[model samples]
Target: MNGSDQTERPDGTAAILSTIGEVAYRWTREGDRLEWGGDALALFGIASAEAIATGHAFDTLLDDASPLARHDSLLIGADHGGGVPYQIEYALRPSGPRGPVLWIEDTGRWYADGGETARRAEGVMRVINERHAREQRLAFLSGYDDVTGLYNRSALLDILDQTICDAKERDVNAAFLLVAIDDFRLINDAYGYRAGDRVLAAVARRIRGRLRDGDIMGRFSGHKLGLVLMGCDENEMAFAAERFLAAVRDDVVATADGTVSITISVGGVAVPHDAGNREEAMERVQESLGVARDSGRGRFVGYSPSPERDAQRQTNITLSQQLIGALSEQRLRLAFQPVVDIHSRETVFHESLLRLAQPDGSIASAGQIVPLAERLGLSRLFDLAVLDRVLETLARHPDARLSLNVAPETAAGADWLAKFAKTVSQRPDIGSRLIVEITETSAIRNLDETAYFVSTVHDLGARLAIDDFGAGFTSFRNLRALRIDMVKIDGSFIATLPTSPDDQIFVRRLVELAQDLGIETVAEWVQDEETVALLSSWGVNRIQGHLSGAATLSPPWK
Candidate 1:
């Protein structure tokens, strides 16, 4: 058919298609001619429809980077008895030279003759610039931080890992530096978070400007940027760190609110020499950064191996491996300590404490393993393990009530809650008998998050309590915000409640305050009747210590 014959369509249908940025076209393979039925001029941003009248003329509009030529994608496919269908997306620069590029989704079917060669194809093309832009943005954000436009933490770590491997193979030295913006929290506090983000972006630009072509930088964490410098030794790492420090320190960052001056602390480690892998390199660089900050702000510290630190690191590594093994082998056990009612002297609940079972028939207390787990970012594993065991115990003994303490990280996030929600869904009845305890220090660290955690636990039919309550000196406002069911007074105050007048006064006031807020107070480390009497007189709800009982591995209910 001729171009004019293929251009005919119902007036209303043609109008609707053109209104929606769609154009229908018929291509004749014999003469390489193209016919447009809709508003081809508007869709292609051309002065007239004749500009794209032929297939060869239309090919000129296809962007050079288009994945495949239109003829190759549509005409080259194998023929079926019926018409073969195809769909493809490509960019077209239809406007005059230097105009914006337009993305189009073309879909249609082609009919082939008896020779199995395509003769003609008819299709519709729709403008898809917005969709293509969104996909491109998501692809960019997968590896880049949108805030500072630097590689994100995951991408940075991947680069660091590869760099370490490359350095080992090349037998050349390299360096990794972690740069932290000192007192960054203060900036966010003084200005708004948006201003703080501007400061980060400015600092990133400054550091990026100073980086060598071979070096790489990324947003490692909040207020911290990681750098990988190639062919650099320990001494060169120090020089690089100082240059970065000056890049951020020499000038002030201008935000919408005002100009703010900031300094950076840098920690550097020579790769393949001081650190054998990414994890080791990160650990040593972090330690170095800590030293720089400790010495003073706006300084750089190169990681130096110390006998004491090395021994401590080795011990931590061994302990972490053992902890992981214990978790996997089911050797991490829980010990129960009873919290007794002050007036009735009956058991209120048993607090579950974690204990490690050594292979040689020895036991390790939570005090020995918990702090290390928290430092090594393994507390969530322990939290989940303890949660599973607690649920199982509660399921076995239908009437047992147990309280379990979680690490600060667990309390701040929803991972533990997600685990609890899954198990509670199966054994919904066990939730009421479970009490989740968060340390006072952790609870107050982020009051809003803690309050949300407490609210969620209560919603799931479990009670929430603040453990080591008096230690953090939680204010009345924060306590009310948490809305916790109970508070366990810090053991330090209860251990000397009978002998120390100051402790007596503190404990008394704390108990009275908790009572006023409708919160039950439990005093810990009660060793004598005198202290119990004192606590009882002050209306303490419960007591847990030597006077009540010590935590034992054996189940109390059995």
Candidate 2:
């Protein structure tokens, strides 16, 4: 028989054009529906031949709105002679048991007609689709918020500027509203940036729901966002902002640790209605934000567009800078909190705390320095300075196994991690004795990255502890995944640990959970002996509170 006439199924289970090639067959049934053979179905994860014959093949290949179904042109080959032919790539997304993708090369017409038939029927998978997918991912990483899936500050401004310029030329009115989360940082401080980011993501979703079709919103800064209301009037703008605020108020962001309550403070300016330029509009909204913060948190302050408010904004900026400068120049000092191991009734370690040393020879708590530092955008720097004090004290005593308090914002910073690694590198000996106490919210900022860092620290002989557990939604997934060495029950939880049966039950369960994971449990703010006894009974491995003593050094730690 001639080569084509040698009717053969070399493999009894299936057939291919060439004995060496993959399975290929065409079946027509169910009103001209076409079904591919085993090779194509297998690429999509189909296990058996009988499965494809049962209309599964039809269910897998075509989608509801497939353009392929509507197009009338025959699948054709290029005008290539019988030499090695070139082929363009295509992707096949399956909708059934096989999984998402399969690629088939259509190399047929090369031999069917005289060489002029073109190389139309060639089957070879190319990397084009994969390459395009990678580019899309890159674009998202560079322009989007990983948590919220919205545009970040950099991407937001670029889009805003383009929209604004286009609107100006077209004589269109586009309003810009700046929404700052009221007490959002407090949530972060109380919870962790990881949990805080979840809240932001939830808030972003709410804003998107409230926006118009042409309008866009982006996260402008940590806890601050911007919305562009295109083709809107003063009244529409008002309605949208109110709509956004109302939506946010309705949200309850849950983290693995706990549920966090939050609210937003917004300031808006209807461009062309209130200001002539972007800078003026942004400044006016900023002033309005200042008004919102000053009046009381959790409310909206509409832009008034006046000189007095602008002046006040400038003054605040100046004061913030001065405060930052003072701290940077040896104006911050160290205080120590003696945390006793409740069961042992002995001081195991003193938590290295921060104090802003004033020129008046008075020291203020870190709680005082944080707001100013944040306003100055120097929170990371302040956190590092605190680390320095902690490290320096360890250098003095060398025997103290101390845990250091950390702020959420600082933990999320690349610079902080870089410096943290450097500090450890400089004093390798200190690594074993240090307990880095990070709040659940802070550690959760970027969970995977933070977990890797935690693992790295553990490798370096440093311990990782989650501070303020039960204050936010932190999960056992993270607890298990990260392998944290310690869990600090939030002081609020400890404060009511005995009085509230729910609290006692939760703490006991938490302690047992930590034990199962080989993580120690620490109770914070244990004020009295009764609380200490309760914590001890609950299996708290350590305790730190006022009863142990206020954080101090020589001079009342003040």
Candidate 3:
């Protein structure tokens, strides 16, 4: 009754025997007491378990006159040296004459090498069980998403590939739909990120409830969702997409903030029976997504390749290469807009805006350079360049103050702080002169990353400001958390301020909030002299826009 007995194995050899042949008993085999299992002795009508071995009191059971006695010899011959594990189809004689000759299990083991072999066999069994358990876990994870227990992207791909193969073999029609969330960023911005995640889970559940038993759905990408619609046509797929959107609109996600509902934009393509492969099918669907996104938000578009769109995409690629050259060749420069002190009517900081110098000696403004750069995934490169140029200029112009315009995408991306640190380390004095400006559109979607980034940069002797403030859903809360150095009232709020009393009041309240938080404020898009005069009276610390006289770099803030 050591650990061995408790472990189901008896005597550190065979596994513990439970009930067998109705009557319960502990069965075991040993070289000396070969019948210690004892169940067999009772079945064979032996007077004693030991007598079976001695051939004395149970002699009749094996004697020539007794058929039962003959059967004992057969059992011994078939077992003993014949091997305990031997399988025989022959008859087994029963005891008491009434018990007919039964064809029995004949299952058990005898060891010539003692229990040493049994111990090794048990260890092998344990290893096999462990390996099998590990394999099952890996198999489950391969098909299931760890986050929400839906199928993962890889699983979806596998399902699509297998379904296509099956459809092809059977000469049947099959298709797939890829649904992408159009405004996931807006939802994430207005609600907390935790709320956004629950929305995704809720969307997944609603989709599942609507879909048939065989249909498969999963989160295709972060912020972009997708579904696989198979055994259907183009028209059938379109109908499913509409149903999916309707389901999502009806489903409300419960979170700490409350219940919130959202919508999705679907793009899909039918798998052609003769299409080259899965990649081609995916490309078709992705093309549809681009069309849906372009047409408007919360809509579905079917796959139809356009040559003009292809050419536009190619042009984008070409422009990206040209821009890279411009960056390296020092062909990019900054244009400045003066940020005037409201009460004193004197400039305090000149925001350094990016402008690319064309080979023909023409300067492309921030509107032209930044929008294109952000689209080409060069937002970080462009922002880092702007910061570097500002630092270099400040070294020579010590008396000059600095503010730099950064695209919203630059702050949302992962490469922000790493790039910022490199620039800051190179120019320590430039820190006080530099102010990093961000739009509400960019900050809203990726607030956590933005907060961490702004905090890190501000700690390193730089300033952070929310540009185009009050335009997005979460600007107020983000402003509180980011604790920025300044706020630039969006131009739209200012454009109508000269006539619209409501616009003027919004600006006043914003200024009051800034004062309470101990953060400065600026008014952007100050177009006319009248707007400038209005912003000044409304208590904006600085004004920047066309009224500041286009944009000049020679005198820095002409």
Candidate 4:
């Protein structure tokens, strides 16, 4: 048969299409005629071929609101004249009109031959419906909470800002209330997270029920709700907050495990009257909330903007901005402190330390600026910058080994480690000479990631050390699980080791523990020769403190 005959006669198409699990069908553009054949009818769960051939209109079969329906005209585009095939997938209502929806992948071509009527037809097959459902779920999750079906933090913030702006421009009044469940952690601790979730959902329902018309309410964050009340003055705001507080006073949430009773602390602020912008307004409201929670649990307080509070927040903002600028400009300096082998009295390595250079030529230690950088989400950036500097410094001193402190977040995550591994892979010479020290708290808090990090660094020919070992619990557990190379004793324990018998016993036992695990022990805060002698007697392998040398700005070995 010629191409035109093949297009017109799809009687044998069902057998051919069924081999590939598709359905065959034909349609005409002029008359909008549709014909169903092959396994396509069976895939769509339509048993009545007569009804499909007689009553089903092409337009009605397409979902009215779908993009497929909007693009129906494109199916018969320029490809028709060249006899080029085209394809589009869309949802099609089933034959019975009351059955389930079926996704159809339709392929069609227009046929024209001398002395024969031109016709357009397409074949369609079943497709997995997950694609459509996934798109819908993503759209829903963008604005609404998956757990409680309330607006999420981002959506709430947008609405709150718009409400505040409208209040400013139109000279209207509004109030924002931030309600937090008091001691929510207690519930989570007693029960599991699932039970805690049930309690939170119950609280959300109660708060939502208390909201009046023209008011917007949403889940702001963990165990917190933000409510925007239209036309609410100071007095009305107080009453509304009290009403919301009273709603959950006697209500007990019933979970599968047991019942949970909860109370809330609320902070309210009059928009535009309490503060000008969203950030300022949120700060004032949060401060009021803090006051309420601090005064007593389950209490409500209204915001009173204070110049002192605003000034303090402004100062923090300025400092954070300056820190960002300094980091970008690479205005950070490194100080090196020597770690000496106790038995040999040989400086084995220098620990790299961080210092921030101020605009006025003075330097600020990492302790003074790193916490602020972390709070402002610059920790990773700062961490990467430190790595870059360490690499450069190491390249300069090829014969010397350097130990660098890693931020908890950067040390415990795969992203930073991947970058570190790639850099070391490029310059294999520095791998054996670099020692990464993770603080005790960071390692124990995220043990799994820490284990991964340890394996990765070891594979890259670098050594891993636990800094401030005795400062937290799980030191022994971490040593047993992680293949550590060294353990640095916290300075506080070492400060009194030469004088205090209790400290001597503790350090002795710690040293024995490290020796048993095949890990070297380094004693910090070695202040005197007596302390050094005591550390050596206890079998500590290395010592790091002022007794050996202060943290010098430049590495002497380099």
Candidate 5:
């Protein structure tokens, strides 16, 4: 008898395979005999080892009907005196002629040395099982959050997409609720990160308890939960939002520091009503969330798309695409508006305004076009384009000075600052000739960042101005903290300064405040000589508007 005919392994092959729950068997290629070295026969419901060894039971044990099963020849290089080891896996046919099939991984090899064969099979099977378990773990982690045990953001998005498709096919409604915990950052700030985590887990549990089994919910991001409700309209969604809000509003979450009661702001949007697609639905819900948070804490708002809002959204979408093309295709044109000395009436400098010329021979003003760029995160592109032109013009005329408007988003970014600094540093003269303007609203939004920008501008030999002064809640404390060169007073007060006594008082006080701080003031929208004279009397240093001159393509200094 050859080595394949051996029924038992005297070598150490049996010990290794037995430890890891693997069974071993041997087959003779010539006689077509199969024999088990361990309890492998019982796995296939064979009556005994004799039943397999006596007949050609190899074919009967295999499920040839299964498309996935492999029954290829086990004899590879077996015709010669020696052959390399090969393994095959197949499905087991029903035992009682009515049972379900079971897949069996049969890793075996022809053995000149049966001990080496068993050792190799044991090693391969162990690796296969470990790899299978590792893959399952990875798959689970990818789809589910480890902390809350909920579907993660990416998985939830897929679910939302599928739900949207299902709703479209069935002509039903779907709504998504965005739940945000109010003052969540304060919790993390006061207590440690551990306490914040406790609050988050508690909130998730409370919200999850209230959701129906059919509905789906997940942690959308930090301090926010997304809930998907099927067959819900705006009214029904409002009720659902109330329920979700009730879950977190009244309960006090016990943390390490103490107990804290939290409130949630919820915003929902209905599909095929408020929006047409998933992206639009998400945008509408986000807007609703903003409205809810802005209203107050512990509030719920359902998105109602007004005709004007819808039209504006459409226009923004169209203009965003156009803005991208404008930046890439160099279609942006610059218009110069002078900010002259209020007393001298001489061109002090030109403020570069951007204009986008459409393919239809229509020009869009910076006011109408730049906001779309800011929203789409292309403000830096627009800013850099204007900067390049300003640099070129300044290079040609050594005496020229240009003030350019920097979008709040662009100024807040480090990348833009680095590039801007590098370009200005190369020519120290450019800094004195350049004036960087940031809006009052933008300055107040992130005062520290804006102050740093001011310092950097001063270092680069450029001047910084707080544009649209008095437009927002401008604290004098922060205003004085910034080392600025100019303050362009907001145009609203100047528009009615001549007629409105109340405006006259506000303008007078504003100019006095700026002078007291030793900051130069430029009064904007000086439409007539009367308004200009009033501003000049109030000690305004400069004036900008139609009175100075309308923004024109031609350079005023020329």
Candidate 6:
């Protein structure tokens, strides 16, 4: 087709195609001649259609890194009978220095001659700049935090894992720093969440600016950043931490709310030296950060291995392994403790406590196993195992009512609730007969999330209780918000209830408040009849202690 026949059609099809950012093209392989239709000059931002008249001239506009070229796509393929169809996405270089690079989706068919050599091709090219830009944005967000524009936690952990591997293979020292902005919550509370976010972004920028070229930085969590310093030993790590601390501390971040001075506490660990794996690295760095914060805010603490701490870690590791083995071997058991009415001394519901049997005929109680399980990230397994056993017990004993305590982590997560919902769906009768207890401390940690958890458990037809109630000193508003079925007063107050008048007053007031809110009160660790009498006089609903019965392996129903 000639230039006028290509660009000027009487039917106005060329005008319609150009409006939609599409252009038609034809190529003759013999003389490398190219022809374009539908306002090709405007669509491609070229001075004239003649600029791309030849195939060689058209190829000059393609990006150097583009995956495919026209000749490669048409000539490299096997010969077909009629025509071979193909589609490719590629970038086109700008015609001028100020022109924008365009992304094009080229789709067409190539025809072959009798000799099986490709000779001619015809195709339509559509601009896909918007779609390509959206895809590129999504790709960037996958590995980055939008707030700080830094690598996110997942990406940071992946890089840290590789760094650990490199340290072991190359025998090169590196350091991982877990940095937290000290008193960040104060900023959020005094200003607003938006101001707090501004501070976080500012702190991230400051820390990133101080890092070496080979180092990597990322947002590890809210108000915290993770940094990996290559070829850094303990001394160097400490020095690096100091530099970061000063970078944040010396500046006042300007936010929409106001200017706020910020300081950061850092915890550093020499990788493959103090920490051999990702988990160990994270754990040690967090421990050091905690120490730094505990000593004083805005300080740097480097991990130093100690015999006692090492021994404790080793013991924990051994215990975790044994616990895993015990769980697999079905040696994990539950002990039942009856929560009885204070006045009637009759059983209300039994609290199911976790127990693990040892090969030497001894048993490990929940107190021994739970904290360690939570620390070692085994609480989810324990929670699920306990839940299965509890469900089975409820199924077998129709008249038995049971309450079970879930770890703080489980209380904050959805997995336990999902399992409970599934089981209750299968055995509808068990839901009303079961109670889930979350510690008061855990409930107060994030009142909003705990309230949602309470609401979900109630919707699933199960009762929810706040365990160790007085320990958290939960506000009346939060207590009402949770809408729990019962509050078990912390054992510490009840342990010395009879002798301590202060404890007596506290217990009486707590019981009165719970009663006023229509929430049941259970006094734990009631040892003597005098204490029980006091609790009964105070109108405590239930009592669980040695006076009633210690948690026993033998099932009460059996």
lDDT of 4 by residue, 114-178 (tens): 22444554545546577768877999999998888889989988998999899999999998899
Error of 5 at 372 (Å): 5.5
Using TM-score as the measure, the top candidate is: 5
Estimated TM-score for each candidate = 0.66, 0.51, 0.61, 0.66, 0.71, 0.70
Runs in model 2 deviating more than 4 A are 1-273, 282-315, 371-376, 555-558
Candidate number with the higher TM-score (5 or 6)? 5
Clashes per candidate, residues 3 or more apart or on different chains: 0, 32, 2, 3, 0, 0
TM-score of 2: 0.51
How much is 453 displaced in model 3, in angstroms? Answer: 4.0
- Residue-level lDDT of model 5, residues 137-230, one tens digit each, is 7998799876677888898878888888888889998898898999999998988778887888888899988888689988788888888998
Residue 249 alpha-carbon offset, candidate 3, angstroms: 8.9
Any idea what lDDT model 1 has? Answer: 0.88
Per-residue lDDT of candidate 1, residues 178-218 (tens digit): 99999999999999788888999999999999999899999
**CA-lDDT, candidates in order:** 0.88, 0.69, 0.67, 0.79, 0.77, 0.88
For each candidate in turn, give its C-alpha RMSD to the true structure in angstroms.
7.1, 14.8, 11.1, 8.7, 8.3, 6.0
Query: What lDDT, from 0 to 1, does candidate 2 have?
Result: 0.69
lDDT string for model 3 (1-558, tens) is: 121122233453323332323111222233212223314444444454455442223333322333443223323322233344422222333354454443332333333333333211001111122444576678988887755568878877777777777777887666677776657777788887776777777677777888876777866667555566667777687788888888877666676766766767778877664344678777878878888888886788887667897799899999999999999998888777788776675788888778888999888888888778878889888887876677778777878788777776667665656765776688777677778888877777777878877888787788888888878745465688887888888888887778998988788888888878888888888777787777666667888777665578675622
Q: Could you tell me which residue pairs clash in candidate 6? A: none
| Residue 521 accuracy (lDDT) in model 5 | 94
Residue 239 C-alpha lDDT in model 5:
89
What is the Cα-based lDDT of residue 362 in candidate 3?
83
